[model samples]
Each structure stands twice: as structure tokens, then as C-alpha cells.
Target: MNRPTVVRTRDELRNVLAPARRAGRTIGLVPTMGALHDGHLSLLRAARQRCDVVVMSLFVNPMQFGPQEDFASYPRDEERDVALAGQVGVDVVYAPDAAHVYPPDFATFVEVGGGLTDVLCGDPGRRGPSHFRGVTTVVAKLFNAVEPDVAFFGQKDAQQAIVIQRMVRDLEFNIEIVVLPTVREPDGLAMSSRNAYLSPDDRVRARALNQALTKVLEVAKAGETSTERALAEARAVLAEAGIEPEYLEARDAENLTPVTRFGPRPVLVAVAARVGRARLIDNVVVDATPANEPMAASVDTTGGAPCVGRC
Candidate 1:
């Protein structure tokens, strides 16, 4: 078994992929922050299907975390991450440190605007702009370093995926951003590295995030056109379950404009809430009429968050 080559510096990564680039071969990049899960594996699978080679970047970004957020304690197991990447047929593993990525004079950052940095969970102080700023900065660096033909991001972080696509378009990176459906646990909880913080009991309550989102979809599918009604009911569901609902938004999946009352537009119902030690988020794009199937396609394909082990 030939293990995936481990790269520790930007120069090394670029050199590793140079041959493929020169040969006009396609490459897919799956950027992740360690703590491998089925969700990350799903991204790997998506990249494998579309490209000639796969490069999985594993680095926990401290810039994305807030003052008191779980940056230092974020889950990390590079050994395990690399092992799993090899299993999924990853060709190379690029793992860079802060010094290598953001040297002593690294004062510049890539920020995105157009109201994307301040909507839904990415709002002002509640881990929105700054969080996304860090995400985009790291992603831009990765895109430049490897210069892959395409990149993959999971739908579990629906807003993140949208924001990244916007950045790529605005900044004009010549790479395609492909989003796969959100991978979920058997119990409906979205698979996340943050899930490691959930205790056994917290794990059970975490399902409420999915439950609340699902109820909104059910109501929407049942001919509920009132955006406020779907959001309120889902909020109530979370409140009743002792979960603190942060934001519930119904927006056009394309431009991400806020939707007042549902209509013919593609609407993505997204929510974020604090469940125990974890902050969970989930969304589903509902078609206009009740007879229509759910819109899983966000910026590319179509359908709602797909269940794992079944799709």
C-alpha cells in the first residue's frame, strides 16, 4: 500500500503537485482541519470522483476561532487523519503549521463582502465575519499553494460553502468549488469535528438541531409559505428542547437574500443553536410548491441534506 505523501510546507506542496499541473492533469483539493470523520471522508469521495488526483489539506486554523472559542482545544489527530486519507485514496496530505502559513510579518488577510460576511451564523459578533475571514484566508492560501482544479466543501456548513464560492468568484480563482450534501449520523446529527466535545447526553440532545430544521422543511413541504411561520415553529421546537436558537433564516439559495414569504424562489432554511458544549448548524433548501421535491442543490447540484450510510 503506497501511503499518501505527507507535505509540511507550501513549497513542498507546490513541488509535489507541480508534475501533475505541468502535465495538464486535474487535481481536487479537500481542505480540512484534522479530526477525520465520515463527513470529511464524504468530501474526499466527491473529489475522487471528479479529479485525477486528490490533495487533502489538514490544518486546524486558529484564526477562525474567537477569543474564548475552542481553538487551542480543537480536536486534532494527524496520525489518524492521514491514515484515513490513505484509505479514501488521497494522493497527498499537505499539513502546514502556523509559522509556515502565516509567518512573522503575515499581516494581510482576504475578506469577503456583499452582505455574505454578516448573515445567518456569520453575523457580527456571533462568530460570523471574523470566523469567515479566517476561513477564506486559509482557503485562499490553500488554493494558491496547490492550485488545484477543483475543491470540495460539505453542506453541513452551508453558509461557509456559499461564502467560499462567493470569494472564489469575487477574487477570480480559477478553481471550481463543489459542495456535497451534508453527511449526518444515523440519528440525524450532522457529523462535525466539534461533535467530539459532545458528552453522551449532549449527543442525544444535539439531534434537536436536525429536528428543528426538519420540522421547518416539513411545514414548508406541507404548503406553509409563511417564512415567519416556518422559522417560528422551528425556533419553538428548539426552545422546548432547551436549546438556545441563535438564528433561523429563510433566504434565496442563489443570492442569499432574506425571504419574507416563500414563493417560487429557491429557499434555504438555515438555523444555528447552542446544544450543550457544541454549536450546531443545519439547513435544507425547500422548493416553492409542496408537490416539488426539496432543492438539495445550493450553488451547483440539487436536493436537501442527504443522510449518510444510505446515499
Candidate 2:
């Protein structure tokens, strides 16, 4: 296995990637906070297939987390992350420190415009607005620093993917954004770093997110086009599971605007809920045309059918 060369500073990162760019080789970047998991590796594998160099960034941006959120206890294992990155053929691990990323003099932040972040990113008003702002800012900075030919994001973060895609188009970034399917656990729980916080009971209840989303797919497949009915049924599925759903609504897959009725364009059925201490989000894009069957629901890039290995 080719071990990845880890760099913690922006200067070191540029020094490392400079030659690859000068050599006229394509670069692929997978931006992530540390604590590597199967979902994170899937992104790297996709990047590996397309680019000569695959760079995995492991920085836990303080800005993305709320004051009461898990920034301090959000799980950090740098040594293990590097080992896992190597196993997946990652060429570079760009792990920058908080101070290094945001110097004492740093003041500017990137805010995605056009009210794109009004809904998701942990319920705007309840938490500070900085979550999405921080995500966009850090992404902008990473784009500037790494200068990747292509960048990858998971479909699990459906809204974030949409937000970033808009930012790229609005700001005119040259990098291509690719959103892959969401990877899930054997029992159908969407894989997430925060899954570590779920208690055994919560872990079991957390499967409801995927279960509810699955029902939406089943509803669409059954030719149930009532957006109101499908969404209500999904919420009832969660209610039956005894999970507290935050938001389960139908929206245009691309813009995330509320959709009263399904049509030719794809409808993104997204849901966020709190099963335990962990707040989980999962979504599936269903073709509302009634003729076309439901497409790939979540990001399942295991390179096989769901439950083939994990189950």
C-alpha cells in the first residue's frame, strides 16, 4: 500500500500539490473532517478512479459547529485517519489546524448567497447561521488552496451538496463537483461520523431515518403522487418508530424548494431528525414522473447492492 504524505499547513499542501499541477496531471480532492469511515473512503475511491492524485482533507472546522454542539468532543483520530487514507490510495492528507486555517488576524468568511441555506444545516435560527457559512467558507478556502480539478461530496448531505454546487456556479469555480450516493450501514442506517454518539438503543431507533425515506420511495413506486400524502406517510413512519422528526418535506431535487406536487423533474425527499444525542439526516431523490421508477435512493457506493457486505 502507498502510504499518504500528510501535510498540516497550507504552504506544505501547495508545495506537495504544485508539482502534480506543473506536471499537467489532474487532481481530485475529497474534503472531510478526520475520523475516517466507509462513507469517507467511498469518496476517495471515486476520486482515485478519475484523477492522478487524490487529496483527502481532514479538518474539523470550528465554524461549522454551534456553541452547544460537539466541536470539542466530535471525535478526532489523526493517526488512524492517515492509516485509513493510505489503505484507500489517498496521495495527500491535507490536515490543517484551527489556527493555521484561521489565523488570529483572519476576519473574512464566505456566505453562500440567494438564501440557499435557509432551511437545513441544523435548523438555521435554533443554531447560529455560521454552520453553512463556515462550510462554504472552508470549502472556498480549500478550493483556493488545493486547486483540485474535481471535488467529491456525498449525497447524504443533500442540501450541503446543493448549496456548494450553487456556490461553485455563482462564484464560477473551475472545479467540477460530483455528488455520489450515500453509504449506509447493514441494517440501513446512513453512515455518519456522528453515529459514534448514538447509544445502542438510539442506534436501533436511528434506522428509522432510512426506513422513512425508503417508504417515500415505495410510495412513489406505487404511483402515489400526492406530495402531501407521501410526506405525511413518511413522517408517520418516523412517529411509529418513536423518533422525533425535525423536517420531512418534498422539494425540488436541485433547488430544494418546496413542491406541492410531483412532476417530471426529480423530487428530493429529505428528512432530518433526532434519534438520541445524535442529529441525523438522510435523503433519497425519487423521480416523480410516475413512469420512471425510483432512482438510486441514497449514496451506496459499496460497488454492490445494499447489504451485500455489511449485512
Candidate 3:
């Protein structure tokens, strides 16, 4: 397998991509914080299929981690990550160091407001808006550095994807945001780099997060429209596993508004729980239309539109 050329600074990355741009080849970026897994590979595969050139950003962004969070202990295996990216046909791996990404003079941040940052993972009592602020800042920097035509993200980070799309739209970044389905384990657990923190027992218990969302999916497919009813099913599932979710709620899939009942708009059933040392999150989007099919967990939008309808 051909190994991806690794570049650690903005200038090197730009120089590496310059040829592709001059050749009129579409470039795709899969931004990551290292710890390559099937979830990350899924994004890479999608990028390889969609664009002529693929660039993966392998920075473990400290800005996105809270002081008390696992920033210090987060997994980092650059060698393994690069090998995997190579297997997936990634053309370049832009793994910048902290100092390179955030120098002494770094002061700006990108915050996506309008109520998107105050809920779910961004709940004031949780990671809050600061987490997203870090995310947006790094992503904006990546967009500027790579200048790719399209960016690929996984739906497992549904809230993050939504927030990034909003930022792209508000900032008028000329790039397409293509979100793919959440890749899950055989037990239905959503893939996350944080899964590495889970003890064996916690790993088993973590399935409750997905089980709860699956319950919501079941009820929604059965014509259950009441958000409370759907959430109740999810709660029962979590309770059976002796897991108390930090948050288990349903919302408007598009705007993240609180959804009282599932009507014309699709409903996003999201859940977050801390098992052992890992804090895990999972979600499923249910189409409320008569068809009652499960909607794609993400939206694909271009030209700064938050999304193209249910894209």
C-alpha cells in the first residue's frame, strides 16, 4: 500500500495540495483527531470516492477538550493512523502540532450560535459552547489551509456536523459539507475514538446508548409520533442497562429545535451517557413522513446552505 505523505505545517500542506489545485482535481478533506477507526475510515472512503484527491487532517485538537476532560489521556497513534489512511487511498495526511495550529498569538475562534451550541453536547452543564468554539476554530483553520472542494464528516457526531454546516453557511465558505451515515459495531455501538477509554465492562454497557436510540427508531417506525413516547421507550432501554444518560431527548433534525411531537419534520433521537471512563453519544434520525423510513443521519449541503432540505 502507498503511504500518505505526512505534512505537519500549514505551508507544507498548502504546497502539497498546490499541484492538485493546479491540475483542476477536486480535493476532499477528512478532518480527524487521530485514533483511526472504522468510523474515520468510512469518511476517508467517502472522500476517496467523491474527490480526485483526499487529505486527512490528523490533529488531536487540544482546543476542543475541556480542562477536566481526557485531553491528556486521549489516544494517539500517528503511525497506525497514517497506515490506515494509506490503505484508504488518502493522498496526504496533514498532522500539525499544537504550536503550529495555535501559535502564541492565536486569539480568534469561530462560534456558531442561534441556539445550536446551547444543547446536546454543547449543553451549558456539559461541554458547553466552548467545546464547539474549539471545534469550529480548528475546522475553520483546516478549511483555510486545505481549501478543499468538499469536506467529509460522520453522522455519529451529528451535533458537530450540524454546527460545522452552520458555520460554513454563515461564514460563506465555498465548500460542500457531505455527511455520511454513522458506522456502528456489530452490537450496534456507535464508533468513537473515546471508546478506547471504556473498560471491558463499560464497553458492554455502552451498548445501552445505541439500544436507546434503536428503541426510539423502533417506536418511530411503528407510527409513534409523540416525542415523549419515543423518549420514554429510550429511557426504559437505558434503565434496563442500569445506565442513566446525561441527556436523552428528541429534536427537530434540521434546526435542533425541541420537538414535542413528530410531525412533518424529521425527529433526531439523541442520547449521551458516561460508562466507566468514556462518555458516549449516539443518535438516529426518523422521517415522520408517511413512508416512515429512517432518514440519513446527516445532510449534504454546498454553497453555504446549512443543508439541502433533508440532504
Candidate 4:
């Protein structure tokens, strides 16, 4: 087993991986805060298979957190994460401190304007207005620092993936954004670091997030064309499970845009709900048209056009 090398600062990371980058090695990056899990390991495996070298970034980005968000209490288990990264075949781990990444007088942020940020992650009441801005800014910094040929993100963060994809295109980062399927627990709950905050009952109720999306998929498969009806079924499932649904809708599976009517394009039935203090989200894609239908064709949510994909 090749133990993964840990690089704590930008200078150390560059010094360690500079040779590989110069040799034209295709590097893949999986960025996450510490506290590694099976879902994150799945991403590392995917990166290992596709790229010559894999770099996993373990930085708990404070910029992405809102004032009321749990930035202080966000989980951190560096030793465990480092051990898991080695087990999962990560070549190098970039673990940088907050002060190192962001200086005291740091200014400038990446903001995806034109209503993109305003839709999903934007602060409706200017509450989290800087959320996506922080995300894009840090991601941009990571891209520059690691200089990976490709980056991997999880589908569980549908909006973040969409926003990052758009950012890459707009900024011309020359990096491929590969999104992996959402890994879930056996009970269908999407895996998330935040799950640690859930109580036992809340953890059980969290499964409703996936269950609701599954119900929507069933309805769509049953020839139900009414998006409202499909969403209603999902809402009922969540309600029965004692989860307060924040949003339940079918949308373009690629851009995270809401779709009023289903067509031949693939639609994503997505749900987000709060089970106690944990906010859980899940989604399933459904074919808008039957296989026998003439116009039926698979949709690529991650490809072409913006605002067409949903989570």
C-alpha cells in the first residue's frame, strides 16, 4: 500500500506534485473538508481510475458558510481522513489551513451572475448572498493551486455542481468537471457529512428524502405527466416521515432549472427537507417519454445549455 503523501501548504503541494504535472500526467482532484466517508472514497476511486495521479483536497472552506451556519462545529477528523485517503489510493492530499488559504486582507470573489446564483444557492433575502460566491472563489483557487486536469464532485450537491460547471465554462479553467452519482446508505438516505448532526429519529426520517424522490420516479414511470401530481406524492411521503420539505419538484436534470411540464427531455425529481437540524436532499432521474415513444431520447443534464439540469 502506497501511503498517501500529505501536503499542508500551497508550496508543499506544488513541490510534491510539480513533477507529475510537468510530466503531462492527467491529475484528478476530489475536494472536500476532512472527515472522509465511503461516498468520498467512491469519488477517489473514480479519480484514480481516470487520471494518472489523484489529489484530494481537505479544506473546510469557511467562505461557503453563512453566518448562522455551523462553520465552527463542522466536523473535522484529519488523522482519520488521511488514513482513509491512503487506503483509497489517493496520491497526494492537500490540507491547508484557513489562514493560509485566505489572508486577512483577502478581497475578490467569483460570482456567477445572470440569475444563475440567484436561483438555487443565492440568498433570497440577501441572507446567503455570498454562499455561491465563496464556493466559486475557493474552487477557482483550488483549480489554480492543484492544476488538475479533471475535478470530481458528487451529484448530491446538484446545485453546486451546476454552478461549478458554469463557472468552469465561463472562466475557461481548462479543467473537466466530472460528477459522480450520489452515494447512499442502504436505507436510501444520501450520504453527507452533515448526517453526523442527526439524532437517531432524525436519521431514520432522513430516509424520507430519498423515498420521496423514489415516489416521484414511480409516478413518472407510471405514465403520469402531471409534474404537480408527482411532486404532491413526494410531499406526502416526506410529510408522513415527519420531514419538513423545503422543495420538491421535477426539473431539467442538467441545469437545476424547474420544469413546469415534462417532455422528451430527462427530468429530475428532486427533494430537500429538514429532518431535525440536518437538511437532506436527494433526486432521481425519470425519462419524460416512454421507450416506445418516437421522441424519446436520453437527456444529458451535464451537457449543453445552462439551467436545463435539476437535482
Candidate 5:
């Protein structure tokens, strides 16, 4: 197996990717917090298919984790991550240290203001805007360092993907943001690095997140457009599995605003729950229209089908 050349600093990344830039070859970036899984590799495969040079960043960004969050316990295995990237034909693995990513007196941050940072995972009582601030900042730094033509993200992080897309547009990053489908285990649980923390029982309970989202899709397809009504069905699914979600909400997928009813624009039904030591999240984008009107986007009703994956 061919191993990707791993670089540990911004200068090394720039020096490495400069040739591709000079040669006018398109470079695609897959920014990750290491702990490569099928969900992450799916993005890598897409990048390999679309770009001449595929750069995957393996930095486990400290800034994104809240004080009580599992930054310390979050998984990291550079050797295995590099092997996985190599398997997908990833050209470069930029795995920088925390000090390098956030140097001393590092005061700058990138934030997407307005309501996008005010709801769901961004709620002030939860991870809040600080989480996304950390995310956008690191992403901006990566954009500057790699200067790739495109960036890949998974739809499982529905809000993060949306927020990053906004940041890209507002900041004029000159990179294409491609949101791919969420990958899941055969049991319907969305694949996440945090899944590593799940105990066996927690692993089974974690399936509720996807099951809940699937319930929302079912209700919407049945002409139940009321966000409250659909979410009620979703909550029941969580309740059945004895999994109380931190937040289960339906919002306008495009702007992340509260949606009273699913309309022409897609509605994002998302859930975040704590299962044992793992904080798992899952979402399905609902494109249900009234029975009288045609559906807005093609959707898959299969139990574990991802929201954006089918849409």
C-alpha cells in the first residue's frame, strides 16, 4: 500500500501543494479531526475522483471542543489514519499539532453570525457559537494553507456543513464546498469518530438517532408537515429506545431557520443524543410537499437512508 507523505506544519503543506498549484492541477481538501472511518473515506473517494491532488487534514482541532467535551479522549491514530487515506489514494495528510494550529496569543477567529450559529448545536447553552467559531477558524486556516480548489464535508454534520458553506460564501474562500451523504453502520447509526466511545449497549441505543430522523421523514411523507407534529413522532422513537436527545429540531435546511411546515425548500430534521460516553448526532433532510403538490426533491424512505444522501 502506498503511504501518503505526512506533513506537520503549515509551511510543509504549502511547500508540498505548491507544485500542484503551479501546475494548475485541481486540489481537493478533506478536513478531518483524524479517526478515519467510512464516512470520512467516502469524502476522500469523491475528492480523488474530482481533483488531481487530494489533501486530507488530520488535525483534531482543540478549539472546537467545549470545556467538558471529549477533546482529550477523542480518538487519534496517525499511522492508521494515514493507511486509510492511502487506501483511498489521498495524496497528502496534513496532521498539525495543536500549538501549530493555535499558536501562542492566537486571538483571531472566524464566525458565521446571524441565526445559523444560534440554534441546534450552536445553542448558547450547548456547544454554542464557540464550537462553530473554532470550526470556521481552523477551516479558514486550512483554506489558506492548502489553497485547494474544493473541500469535502459529510451531511451528517448538517449544521456544520451549512455553517461552513455560509462562511465560504461570505468570506470568498474561492473553494467549492461539496456536502456528501452521511455514511452509516448497517444498523442505521450515522458513523462518527465519537462512536468509538460507545459501549455495546450504547452502540445499540445510538441507532435511535437515525431511527428518530427516519420517523420524521415518514411523518412528512404522509403529509404531516407541521414541524411540531413530525418532531413528536421523532421524539417517540427516541423515547422508545430510552434515549433522550439533547435536541431534536426541524429547521429550514437552506438557512437553518425554524420551519413551521415543510415546504418547497427542504427541512432538516436533526437529532443529537448522548448515548453512554458518546454524543451521537444524526439528521435527515425532508423534502415533503403537500399531497396536492409534487415533491420538491427526490427522497428515499428506506429506514436508514440519509437525508441529503437521497435528496
Candidate 6:
């Protein structure tokens, strides 16, 4: 088996892949913190299918985490991640250390500026203002370093993907931003690297994240249009499971903007909640047209079937 070549710094990565870049190859990038799983494999596979070469980034970004967040505890397994990426046909792995990516005097950042950052990730009350800013900044740096034709992101970070897409468009980056479906466990818990932090009981409680989002879809499919009503039902489901919800609402899939009056648009029912120390998130897209109404079959960009299961 041909193993994927691992590059540890931006200069090494550029040197190794210079020929491919010069040849105008279509490259795909899958960014993640170390600790690979089947969910990440799905993104790698999607990238493999779509591009001539694939680059997987394994950097646990510190800027995205708050002071009280688990940045220090976030898992990292480089050897395992490389082995798994090779097993799934990844061509190159870019695992850069913190100092290499961000020098001590690094002063620039890519901020989405205005309501975009505030709506989803920003804490307007000065709680976590730079959270999304850090995300966009690191992603912008990665895009510049790897220079991939396309980048794949898991939908478990739905708002993050939307934010990045907007950034790419606003900044005029010539890359396609592909959002993949959230891979889940058998019991409906969304798969995440942070899931490693969960105790056995916390793991069981984590399923409520998926269940609550599913409840929103159930209510929407049953002809419930009120966003308030749908969110109320989902909140009740989470409460029943003893989960404290961070946010649960239906919104336009493209913009991540809240939807007040729901009609036949493609809407996403998203949920975020804490299960022990780990924050779990999951979402389901609901096509609000009548049951008898036939629409075009839309496949998830992740190359999986659209999630249409019961709540």
C-alpha cells in the first residue's frame, strides 16, 4: 500500500507539492484536529473523489477556543491520524505545529465583521467575541498554504461552514467550499473528536443533541410552521433528556440566517448542547413541501443520502 506523504510545515508542504500546484492540479483539503475517525474518513473520501490530490490538515486551532474551553485537553494522535488517512487514500497530510503556523508576532486576522460573526458564534456580551474570528482566520491561512481547489467541512459545524463560505466569497478565494453531512453513531450521537471527553453516561446523554434536532424536523414535517413552536418542542425533548441546550432553531441552509416564516425552502434544524464537558451539535435538513410534492433529488455534498430518518 502506498502511504500518504506527511508534510509538517508550510515550506515543506509547498516544496513537496510544488510540482502538482505548478501543473494546475485540482487539490482538495480536509482540515481537522488530530484523532481521526470514520466521520473524517468520509470527508477524505469525498475529497479524493473530487480532486486530483488531497491534503488533510491536522492542527488543533487554539484561537477558536475560549479561556475556559478545552484547548489543552483536545485530543492529538499524529501517528494514528496519518495511518488512518493513508488507509482512506489521502495523498498528503499537513500537520503543522502552532509556532510554525502562527509566529509569536502574528498580528493579522480575518474577521467576518458585522452581524455575520455575531449571529452564530460571536458572544456580543464579550463572552467569546473572537471565536469565529479565529476560525475564519485559521481557515484563510490554510486556504493560502494548501491552495486547494476545494475544501471539505463536516456539517456538525454547520455555522462554521456557512461562515467560511461567506468569507471565501467575500475575499474572492477561488476555492469551492463543500459542506458534508454530520456522521453519527448508531444511537444518533454526532461523531466528534471531542466525544473522547465524554464519560460513559455523558456519551449516552450526548444522543439528546441528535434527538432534539430530529424533533424539530418531525414538527416541521407535520405541518408546523411556527419557529417558536418547533423550537419549543425540541427544547422539551432536550429538557426531558436533561440536556442544557445552547441553541435550537431552524434557519436558511445557505446563509445560516434565522427563518421567521417557513415555506418550501431548504431549511436546517440545528441544535447545540453540552453533554458533560463536551459540547455536542447536530442538524437535519427539512424540505417543507407537502408529502405529495415531488422535487429534485438533492444529494448531500458529502456524497451521502440526505438525513431523512425519524426524530
If both were scored by lDDT, which would come out higher, candidate 1 or candidate 4?
1
Off by over 4 Å in 2: 289-292, 296-311
Model 3, backbone clash pairs (residues 3+ apart or across chains), number: 0
lDDT of 5 by residue, 105-175 (tens): 99998989879987899899888788888888988999998999999988888888888899999998899
Give the TM-score of each candidate.
0.92, 0.93, 0.93, 0.90, 0.93, 0.90
- RMSD of candidates 1 onward, in order: 3.9, 3.8, 4.5, 4.5, 3.7, 4.2
| Superior candidate under TM-score, 2 versus 4 | 2
Error of 5 at 39 (Å): 0.2
lDDT tens string, model 1, 229-261?
Answer: 988998888887788877878898767889887
Candidate 1, run of 10 with poorest lDDT: 302-311
Estimate, for each residue in 198-232, the C-alpha lDDT of model 6 and write its tens digit.
99998887877777777776676677878788888
Query: lDDT per residue, candidate 3, 49-124, as tens digits?
Result: 8999999998888888888888888888999999999999999999988999899999898889988888998899
Q: What is the lDDT of residue 39 in candidate 2?
A: 84
lDDT of each: 0.79, 0.80, 0.82, 0.75, 0.82, 0.75
> Candidate 5 or 6, higher lDDT?
5
What does the lDDT come to for candidate 3? 0.82
- How displaced is residue 53 in candidate 3, in Å? 0.8
Q: Which ten residues in a row have the lowest lDDT in candidate 2?
A: 302-311
Q: What is the lDDT of candidate 5?
A: 0.82
Q: By the lDDT metric, which is better: model 1 or model 5?
A: 5
Point out the higher-scoring one by lDDT: 2 or 4.
2
Model 2 accuracy (lDDT, Cα)? 0.80
